[model samples]
Target: MTTKINRHLTWQRMCACMATCAMAIVVACPIAGFASVQTASADDTANTVSTIIVRDGMLSRYTQLGGAQGILRQPLENEHPTANGGAEQRFQGGTLFWNPSLRGSYLVRDGMLSRYTQLGGPAGRLGLPCADELAVPGGASQVFQGGTLFWNPSLRGAYLVRDGMLSKYAAARYEQGPYGLPVSDEYAWNGGARQDFQYGSMFWNVSDWWKYSSQGPYPNLAGVSNLNVAVSIASQRVYIRDGERVLYTMITSTGINDWTPRGTYRINGRGPSFYNRNEAMGARNWVRFIGNFLFHSVPIDSSGNYIVSEAWKLGQPASHGCIRLTVADSQWFYNAIPDGTLVSIW
Candidate 1:
């Protein structure tokens, strides 16, 4: 478990990529640069106090690998100092970084750089670009010793997915689910990493899609899910719909042995509430669809035990005048449907 305070504190830690230094350069050094250097060949912009100096070997490599023929085009700035005694240079396509202990330079560009800069660049937790940005299906990404940055046009912006949080994002199909793309960097939360997405906030330790709100931690199911409902007395089935689109059809148990009034009904309020002749604690998420009859989990006996086995009774006619649903189905019914929505029973 994580402490409540840990979820709120910010740390100055970076990743393994910046543990060393490389080629020299100039910029308002706030973060460590990522790369290595062999020799120097100054550009025309060199000898200027503001532009810093560029190396000939490094420039040659860049020209051949990432210059005119490459996506980066031309150099934007000369080499400069980065955090942790590192050197760096800016190119149209991206930024180049070098550390003293390494033998070569690494380039950072595209969406990866965008996310890094958002994370405070080298000055923040992700010290430097450890690897070149790589292409993937539908988008691009770069791996830092500290974490991974992901960019997909559909997500609208670059975002970080690192640590155990990566597994959580993958579980939700990484930007495909209702959670959408991450909008905020991972922070301490509930003793684990937390990230906010387009649809919801993900807590690595607490849950994949939950946020602390005034009402307490809740799922942000705002953009998805809907509230249309229907029940068939003859087939003993419940149908939940999103407008005219069916969200799900579930087998249910209707008052097989008793009078289950049929007609249109408005769910008045939470069930498990006493009205007419029925009341029980075991019955949960109750919604009254007809007189005294409710759409609720299997009715519990006087002793407070569910009298019907959910697996066995489903898809069959059962229940004591009430519509019987499984625990999960009942919860979904209550949570997804608004109180005043129409519940048609036929």
Candidate 2:
């Protein structure tokens, strides 16, 4: 009876050892369906050590993006709460903001990351990035919840435009338009807001928005008007047109210091000759368009002798504040251009 009882005890011990070994094997082998291990941290204790499992969602995304070796480098923080209950994790290269309901996580990095943060990150008008940055023709671009951000190699960095400003930009064909890409965020100016672009700026007020092109201030004809005079400061040329038809083109000189005002003005007065004692010079066939501003011939001396050197400055900027035309051109202008004709200078 004693032998039989000893044998029974040995068998029970063997069965218990087998069950323990099986459990250990199950734990050691990784589960096939679960995400691969991303990162592990350990907590030290006197009698036990516990492992923190960092996996799934964001972790999975991080792993796919090359993790420690990718542009994002290493994770700087564990996943944390953000606006709208979303989660975000900071990395050496950039940041990953995750919104599970919105499908998945998206990355914002480099110059774009800085700009996004400046605009208030996910809490700002831009919200979260909807997708990864895309390679555009000239640079890169990324779309967001509220609007889009664009980057160009030729520009200082990335910039964003949204709401009404974005609509205006789109209407002008974005980068292809006269404005090109945005150079600045919408900022307060005068009484409203202003957003600058590559070529021009857009101003906003309580009632409406308008574009101020850097090329020059042009009046909105809507349809062609009867007569308008346009001046090109850069080209140093004057265009006299009738409802879009080129009536005449004349070489001219503008303010050397860019003192000539840029805008649409009316021909308010005309004179046969006038002299500025302060400037010690005079001109003939003068037409006043605005305050102390005029279109006249090259400078003449008190002896009424044409200053040959001043006339040589045609097709360039050399005047104090007036538009200088040639002797014959000014003569024709004084006689032909009537009062109330619009003059646009840039």
RMSD of each: 15.9, 18.4
TM-score of each: 0.46, 0.46
Query: Which pairs of residues have clashing backbones in candidate 2?
Result: none
C-alpha RMSD between model 2 and the true structure: 18.4
Provide the lDDT at 260 for model 2. 91
RMSD value for candidate 1:
15.9
Sliding window of 10 residues with minimal summed lDDT for model 2: 22-31
Per-residue accuracy of model 1 over 219-307 as CA lDDT, tens digit each: 33366455556777765656665666544555577766646777778887775523223443346668876556778765555565555
Model 1, total clashes: 26
Q: Over the stretch 181-250, how does candidate 2's per-residue lDDT look in tens digits?
A: 6777778866787787654566666222211222223333344468888888876777777866655566
Identify the candidate with maximal lDDT. Answer: 2
* Stretches > 4 Å off in candidate 1: 1-57, 64-66, 99-104, 167-181, 187-193, 197-201, 207-346
Clash count (model 2, backbone only): 0
Global fold similarity of model 1 (TM-score): 0.46
Displacement of residue 140 (Cα, Å) in model 1 is: 2.7
Overall lDDT per candidate, in order of appearance: 0.59, 0.70
